[model samples]
Target: MADNQLGEFLRARRGAVSPDTVGVPAHGARRVAGLRREEVAVLAGVNADYYARLEQGRERRPSAQVLDALGHALRLDPDARAHLHRLAGTAPVLPLGRTPDRVSPALRRLLDGFPGSPAYVVNRTLDVLAANTLAEVLHSPFSDLDNLARMTFLDPAGRRFHTRWDRTAQAVVGHLRESSGLDPDSPRLRALVRTLCADSPDFAGLWHTHTVRGKTHDAKHFLHPDVGPLTLTYLALDVRDAPGQQLIVYQAEPSGPDAEALALLAALA
Candidate 1:
């Protein structure tokens, strides 16, 4: 990583964004790469000296207001803003490795009970925490993989499985970019990103976009090898008591091919 957490994150996000993104002219004969420190300071409505101190790691603490200003100036999405706070030691430290908190017994039972719908839990970095049998069967291609972001970008079969592969890929990349903001020092996440970037040129290209998006409600189209094409609605529910885990439920439209496909997958499960 870079010298300090804040500096490193700033440097990484800065390089990811172009001057045009922040409304600064891409003038010729620029000295430093990406946005200059003073430019960012000005855009963030802070003194150049203060911004410089923050980026250089000389200043460790920043008020929430200042952080929000900086986040806005950087065009950071929620994930990115949360990441910035974490790097600044504002957010609580998360557990290391894949030792995610166990899914609540209630949630597990819920998944088990809803045999028709595919449901699973994912951590902040898109690590598959747990899945129902049907979820495993429905997302068979991805279940063997640990990280959804990595699978989306690195798996060749992903291209065919995700009908809107390009859009999905971008969304995954954006989500990862947002995550980088929240947990800049997560060694596991950093390693995953490095590995994916090195292995997949598409991942590398998308990472450079510096986009961030949360896993809000979205529609997904799946081309199941056995079930054919199915469209489903994906809902993300923050596990009420489970801080970092999210319950993702996939449901198909009623009385449609998608519904039939779900039934078939459930039977196979």
Candidate 2:
């Protein structure tokens, strides 16, 4: 992790914002992309020097109100705004270090219950903590299903398995960014990120974007070797007892082609 994550986030997000989007008139040719520091200060309703200090790491703590204003100026979404607050030290931080690796018996039962569906448990780092039989079958293409990041970037089968590889890459990177903001001191996360960045140029480029998101309800498209093409909608639920654990279940519509594919896959499993 970078020493000055707050500054790094601010700088990266600042560069991402378009001057035209914020109504900052582009006078002529500008040396730097995005809005200038002074423009951001004006939009955020703060002194230019103060904002500069905030970005340079000379000032660390910022009030919630100021962080809100900055978030607005940066055009951050709910997740990104929360990430900004976290970076500014205004948001409540999670307990330092890695979360518990064990998945609860109840969750394991839930996964087992979904014999027709593909279900799995993953932590903030996207480690496949626990998976149902169907999920194991669904992800059998990967060399190892231990960590999703590794599977997506390191394994050759990831690109072939995921129909929308580009979108999957973005979602994985965004999820990592969201997790890192909440638990910055996790050695597991740090090492995983380091390994991915070193080994995969795709991961390295997306990591620098600083996109923050958590897995939620979304449709996933996959190309299975045995079943051909399968599309399933997934719901990601945060385990109430576990702070960072997310239980993801993928389901296909009843009586649909996808459901047939899933059924065939389950039979094979």
Candidate 3:
């Protein structure tokens, strides 16, 4: 509900990073949430007032160099760093409300080739724009798998689907939060968040945390009812033509337990 997002995210991420983690000495019992404004300025090599202005949303546009420095100072990973650039308006962005609807036929054909791989395409807001058969089976728990965030937060069965449900929820929320910054005025995204906030307190609390992240993954664990358990190596690649879309593919090694599970599911299907 708090639309002062740049400030909120800065504050949240700051709280997450400790002074000791970044080689800043942990002084006496501090009454602050995270690093002081001056500490962040020192770490990022900027004037304290300048950094404070950015956080306060008074200075919305930060040069790429300054954003890079701030990102490094915050110890943000690649996804978070990219998110920071977007928030600072240093990245090429589509007009706020425009979201892509098309997934190329060539890409769908590519997904069809991977019969054993669970592959799908998701938009910036995590809508299931397209998917392979294996991917559909992978996400069968959601009666209508319209959006990933809705399934993750609103669906009760999400707990059983994800092995580490809590972490999965956090990651999903973080990705959604990041997407919000990428396109703040998107009606679809704003409506989804509004619904989730009203329907689920869990979602509301997580949203307030302002954690910005996306699916930058090597592997993910799942507990499927039919497959038992699976650990799939995952990749999320941007669909360059469709700016907001990502091609998410998942794989299990040949002859491995996960592969066996996939085979079994394939046979059953």
- Best candidate, lDDT: 2
Candidate 3 C-alpha lDDT tens digits along 145-227:
77888888888778788888778788888889888878877888889899999998998888877787877666677888887
Which parts of model 3 have CA positions greater than 4 angstroms off?
1-3, 95-97
Q: Is candidate 1 or candidate 2 better by lDDT?
A: 2
lDDT for 1 (candidate 2): 87
Error of 2 at 173 (Å): 0.7
Q: Quote each prediction's TM-score.
A: 0.77, 0.96, 0.89
lDDT of 1 by residue, 1-269 (tens): 34476776676666666788789987688877778888888988999999889978999899888888988887777777887887777776564443355877888888788788888888778888788888888777764756788778777678888999988998888777656665666687788888988999998887765556788789998898888898999999887677667888999989988999899988888
Candidate 2 clashing pairs, residues 3+ apart or interchain: none
Off by over 4 Å in 1: 1-3, 12-35, 93-101, 142-145, 173-187, 204-211
Q: Where is model 3 poorest over a 10-residue stretch in terms of lDDT?
A: 92-101
Q: Poorest 10 consecutive residues of model 1 by lDDT? A: 92-101
Question: Model 3, residue 115: displacement in angstroms?
Answer: 1.8
Number of the candidate with higher TM-score, 1 or 2:
2
- Clashes within 3 Å, all models in order: 2, 0, 0
Model 2 residue 135 CA deviation in Å: 0.2
